[model samples]
Target chain A: MIAFESVGKTYPDGTVAVADFDLEIASHESVVLVGTSGSGKTTLMRMVNRMVDPTQGRVTIDGEDVAATDPVALRRSVGYVMQASGLLPHRTVLDNIATVPVLRGTGKAQAHERAAELMEVVGLEESMASRYPSQLSGGQQQRVGVARALAADPNILLMDEPFGAVDPIVRAELQTELLRLQRELRKTIVFVTHDIDEAFLVGDRVVILKPGGHIAQIGTPEQILAEPADDFVRSFVGADRAERRLHLQQVAGREVVVDASGRAAGVLEQGGTP
Target chain B: MSWVSANLDTIAEQLLAHIAQALPAIVLAFVLALPIAKLANARGWLRGGLTGTAGLLYAIPSLPLFIVLPLMLGTSIRSPVNIVVALTIYGLALMVPSASEALRAVSRETLQAATAQGYAPWARFWRVELPLAGPALVAGLRVVVVSTVSLVTVGGVLGVPSLGMLFIDGFQRNITAEILTGIVLTAALALLLDALVVLGGRLALPWASGRAPRRRTAPRDTGQEAAR
Candidate 1:
């Protein structure tokens, strides 16, 4: 479990990045911190690894204060992913994935074998293992990034806009992949994204932050969509969310429940009314 | 050409001596420049001062440097060490900035990834930064080799054993054939060395080819080609 107790971060320039933030993420839960720019969503995620130290309060993982732990060791124990794949251009995909394991003194043969398995787990072909990150497309590179993060199999995965750099199609595909992986692995994940739809899709609980990293509401996606805490939360979720309330619509002679985007989202069961 | 053929043994000896002097200096300069360039990368003031010092060293005339190196080092004026030291200094002067630029060219994202992946700074420098810097570093080496090759000819003015002796002898004897031969041979040597550097770069950075897995088709378009 990760817990933040009245955590606040103020820059040396006297800018408040995160103010009076408190959150607790249970084990095996995927919690997303959602906000627009300047919301300090990224800052809150980074503070877990001591990449940004909180000035006012403490963050603990499994009840151990993260600030007291060695920074490198703490970072190694948590998996972190970023946008643009953040891959080493000179390294082959396999070597990139093998990096963390090898750093922890795992033998080369074992690390490479683990990397190969992870490539398959992350939906990349074995043939791509020898190719450099530059040789892969944006989507492929992101998958490699995910695989590399999972190579050491840390209990907590910190993802900061992991799919934000890819196209819409690839973004959806990676989200599905993440859902599948989460179901199987059940690792505690802290995800940060500006996309509300993505937060709803991937997060078990969404912590909506206002402009300066102060929580507006904390609830499940269904709860947030059903009952926005305030006007800002309602506006951020958008009016289209109400249309997501399932109602049968006629398309030609067939009836289907259309989603907010006017696409046929699903079909009603036999007894449900339009 | 006739003088060159008749005195082929002497010409060959001078050519070997030229290679002997230039190769070590180029290698030494390359080795030394890496740490200096890495230092320069981390600090702004050090980079500026070091690069400025290199530019000043490079701007000095080779003849003066060659003449004064023995005095500074307490070696005999006739020692080949003078030519070697002078040429090495020139190589370092030319290479330091290139090395800095090459290392700096590595993407910041890649470095951040390495750090997040738990690589210690030194390991990341060797495994990630240096390999990524290969193409630019080799390009720098090509410039250094060609410049050093030509500069070795100038050392002959100080009676250093090099191809430059042919130019002096040709000038003294008024043999245009000897001067022409020396010019041709030096140009050929420079081209050879440049080609070697390019080939070595290819060998070292096979992934830098930027080619996709080959498909058996006439007009297959790779994304990297389009990206360029």
Candidate 2:
């Protein structure tokens, strides 16, 4: 479990990124923080890992306050994935995945073996194992980045716009992969993205952050779509959110493309919602 | 033609003796440069001072340095120290920048990834940082070997038993063939040293073939892994 109790950040220059944020993300839940550029969602997430120290209040991971923990140790147990896939260009896909494990006292042979397994888990071809990040396409590199994050088996994964760099098609594929991985790993993932659709799709809990580190609304996707907190939340999700809701209702189930006139288009039954 | 045929044993004796002297200085320089380069990467002022010292050493004519060292240390002219000092001067000069640049050229993305992986600071420098920067470092060492060979030949100015002494003796005797022999052997030796450096780099740094990473891995993760 992760909790931010009245956390705030006031930079040395007097700029306030987050102000009095109070949030709790339960274990085994994928919570995505979404907002405009300066809404402090990224700052808030970084605080949990102690990447950025909070000026006031405390961020607790499990039961201990992060401020009291060593930053390196804190970060070691937390998997972080940044956009651009942040894969080490000098390392092969397998080595990149083995990086953290090797650091954490795993021997070279064991670490590499685990990395190979992670590559499989992340849906990468074994042939790509020897390739560098530059040698892989954008999507493949991003997948390797994800695999590297999962290498050490951290209980908490912090992803900052992990899929923002990919094309829509590849983005969808990654999102699906993430969902499957989440189901299997059940990690306490704190994801940050600006796309409301991505937030709705990937988040078990979605946070709409207003400017100045204020949370406009925090709830599940269904709750937020059905009942927006205010105009800010409603606008961020867009007017098409209601229509988009229909898409979610059919998720992971089946594809039943029908004509506009409520008639089945292709191999539809004569009576099955045609 | 009779002189060439009759002096073959003498030529072999001189060549072997000269090589024995030159090889030690070159080998010492190669070993010394690796650690100095590693040190230079961490301390800017030390690097500058050390590099500046190397340049200063190079500026002193090999003849003078060889003579001066014996005078200052009260060591005999025939001691290996004089020759070693001259060769090491060139070695450091050549190795300083090559090693430093290799260390500096280490990519930030690689460092970042290593940090994220939980490597402690020093560990990164040793395991991920040094190993990844291997090719450039070895290339730098290659330059060192060549420079050492060249400078150790110069060490003969102090009466050291070196290839330079062979060349100098040939000059003294006006034996053009003997002089040509030293030059040819020295050049071949330089090339052989270079080839060895390249081979060492490839074997030592198999992972260095990939392009540099855009980011540096964190120092923390690097230290942890290196320490392990």
Winner by lDDT: 1
TM-score (C-alpha, index-matched) for candidate 1:
0.90
- The lDDT, on a scale of 0 to 1, for candidate 1 is 0.87
Return the lDDT, model 2, position A82.
Answer: 81
DockQ, every prediction: 0.35, 0.18
Model 1 residue pairs with clashes = none
Scanning candidate 1 chain A in windows of ten residues, the lowest lDDT window is: A239-248
Worst 10 residues of 1 chain B by lDDT: B215-224
List model 1's recovered fraction of native interface contacts, to 2 decimals: 0.39
Candidates' TM-scores? 0.90, 0.78
Q: Which stretches in model 2 have alpha-carbon errors above 4 Å?
A: A8-20, A35-44, A51-56, A70-73, A89-91, A107-110, A208-217, A221-274, B1-57, B72-74, B210-228
* lDDT string, candidate 2, B1-118, tens digits: 4555777776676567666666776677766776887787778888888877777766777777778788887889878777776676667677776777787888776676566556
